[model samples]
Target chain A: MLKIIKPGLLTTVQDLGRTGYRHHGVVSSGAMDRNAHRIANWLVGNNESNATLEMTLMGPIIEVQEDALVAITGADLSPTIFGKPIANNRPIFLKKGSIIHFDRMKRGCRAYLAIGGGINVPKVMNSRSTDLRAKLGGYHGRSLVAEDILYIRKYSEHTKHTISHLRNQANQIDDFYQADWSVGRVSKIDNTYPIRVMKGRQFDWFTKESQASLVNKQFRITAASNRMGYRLDGNKLSQLKSQEMISEAVRFGTVQVPSDGNPIVLMADSQTTGGYPKIAEVATVDLSRLAQKKPGDMIDFTWITHKEAEQLLIKQEREMKQLLVGVQLRSYR
Target chain B: MEYKLSPMGDQSILIELGNTIDLATHDIVQHVVTCLDSMDHAWIIEYIPAFTSITVIYDPVQVLEIEANPFKSPYHIVANIIEEQIQQIAVLETKKQRTIEIPVLYGGEYGPDISIVAEHNHLTIEEVISFHTAGEYTVYMIGFAPGFPYIGGLPKRIATPRKTTPRSVTPARSVGIAGEQTGVYSIESPGGWQVIGRTPLELFQPNDPEPTLLQTGDKIKFKSVTKEVYDHLEAKLC
Candidate 1:
């Protein structure tokens, strides 16, 4: 069990997310960076979909009541275990009654901490994720607070074996060098500033000049952004009809341009439906990369064909599995 | 002429079918969604539909299977079959939709904008209430917030525009009109709809057996209620 000694800005419990309820208007409000979350779980031998703690730029100071193995990933936050620094990506043993804290992310916006056996939490709508909009799911359906007791799931044979193997060779992570490894970047994304977007559902609704400007321009994330979506400050994308469109299922990473003409990129906790015209969608593989972005960061869009995006996604998935195996085998060797 | 297919997370496809939401293209998009869903591909975890396009989410491991053995991904295989299926369904006509009756109490405190609606339509407040409750509204689709049905069939006379500034929080069951669309708020949320009244109906109940009272394609009819009745239901809601 872990208790939050200090609850940072907006720490919340999240998992692989709740699905099948999209038709009913529910966003899959889970960890902002899914790859980081899942990798943290894999390092601890937890199921790929296990629920974990998603810390924002500033992380919580947690007190563990039981001996466990944990991994910290994403955002490259410098963390310490009981005043001693810890490693990232690889699993490290935590002694009972030890305190873990994160100073601040030197690079990324969110970090994931996957405790061995994953965090045992109640599931709502087939997901252990927290949907802040609906105030449902994950640890009483809210953000983590001071003195919140997070439970660990009952371990399986695989989990027990993985824990024993990693702990037996715990001497490898003895370095005090905290936050060394920069995660594998989403390869060669368009850095011109406008989030690289393929033209969206209502792309044709806008004039040709707007479409060209959207591709070439650089948009800054606005202060009026949260989990619901990111409000971007750039060229306004006007619709020709200006009709009241029936709200429909809106996916994460969708760029919604409201009547105001500014584009808002929906994130982990965005609404399920919206009336804005979608100008582009963030590729699934790159969304995690997008998720790491902080407010005020500049983004540029580079349009790619559907086939290339799919191939990139499949390649990334394959790399994730390899990352899991590579870490475990390297430690043993 | 716009065709941009992007990945949404790990399990969905975002096909930018077109920009605007019109009947001619919307139906085609829906047909593609239903077709992809009807496929036998196990790798596809889920296929969700939207107004203008569909998101087809599939497992990477499943796609890798086809590449591992080319014989598996032939022309007759399930992966390629969805495109043909969509083409067939697109030409079919739309079917009958579900319709429902909704009782509403207009004017007074529940409907703060009834006067605005009446003044804009050039009708008496009583006439506005009667006309509002008389017509049947069709549920084009359910979106925005949960169970918040977007109904069509609003009279042009009462077609009031949205507030210049949206309210920070519109209470649950607050019925509002936006352009020709009239619907009830399933949850207490921020909205810009020209609210005409409130309903006792629990459109979204998270703890109930059925959370949303209405769905896409469902129809609704509004019937005027008394001040006393509105108070009784509002009291029960809390």
Candidate 2:
């Protein structure tokens, strides 16, 4: 059990998310970074899809009520345990009564925290993840706040032993630190990461200049950003047609350019259907990395054949399987 | 009907079967989905069909296992199966799925934009309500928000464009029209649709056992109700 001492800007519980509800117009409101969410659970010897805490850019300060093992993944927010620093992406064993806090992430926007047994929140529509706009799922269908007590189903004795085994081998650090056990070891692609995008259904709606500028120009993530979408500030796209489209279904990573020509990259909490002529969709594998990008982060979009994106996804998935094997081997300590 | 397939995302493939929005094509899309469900390919987790396109969600790694399953394909197999299966059902399922009549109070304080919609369509408020309620609308899709029904089958007499300036907030149950599509506002949000009426029914209740009142293929008609009846239903819904 853990009690919230200071709930930061925003924190909620999330998992792989509720699927098969798109017909109901519900977005799969889940962890923005599914890979990170799963990896945290995987580290705890739990299924990758287990529900866990989704810490936003600024994270909550939690006090451990029970002696338990925990793991932090995703954004590095300079997490501290018992006023002593802890590393993101590494499993840790905390003594009872220690307080844990995560400062605002310097480079990224969100983080994932996992307890071995997963969260005990009620699942709504086959998901426990919070959808703020819809006001459904998660703890009371809202963000976690001060004094909130989150309970996790107790781990099996074997899981307990396994947690401690890794903890015993973990080097104890004084305070804030980087992860000793880094994420699925495909190193973070550097800042100059050329994001690949596939042409959207209405890619041709824009002029040649708009299309070329989209691929060539460097766009910075705008301040007006949230779970719903990220507004990009770049060279305003010039649309050839000023026509209105019948509202149709939209999905994550969809880049919707309004009549004004500014591109708004819709994310997890985006509307189920949209009328704006979409310019492109960022590939799925890159979505996790895109979620990590903070406001003002510079990005350059590169057009890629769908085949290339699919191949990369297959490669990344294979890499993930290898990471799991590494964790299994290292679990022995 | 011509069909084309494209790899949209890593997990899904898009099947653009048709470009039309008539009754025949709508049945085609639904028919394709029902067929896909029965097939139940091990790799296909879920496939979302909307408007004229169907997105088949599959685990590429599992589906693309050439050694295990000779059919190491998602769209090709889905399309082939749909193409073959569609012929078997010579007559499309035109029978109604669900007939839901929503009780609405038109052109009153509840519907603030009724006058604007009427003016835009060059009809009286009473005529607008009569025209709107007279036609039976078919639920094309449920989207934009939970339970937001994208309904078709509106009479041409009262077809109106959306408001030039969208209001920041429109109350739930606000019935609006945007060109050919008419729908009931499921949630209170900013929108540009021209509101002609307001309904007593809660179109979307996330907590309720029946979250959305209508589904695709459902037939809907807006039945005008008096303010007194509207109050009763609203109070009862709460």
* lDDT (0 to 1) per candidate: 0.72, 0.78
TM-score of each: 0.83, 0.90
Q: Considering every candidate listed, which one attains the maximal DockQ?
A: 2
DockQ scores of the candidates = 0.31, 0.49
Q: lDDT tens digits, residues B98-154, model 1?
A: 567777988778889989888888898998888888876766556666677767677
By DockQ thresholds, what CAPRI class is model 1? acceptable
Note the B-chain TM-score for every model. 0.75, 0.87
**Cα-based lDDT at residue B213, candidate 1:** 85
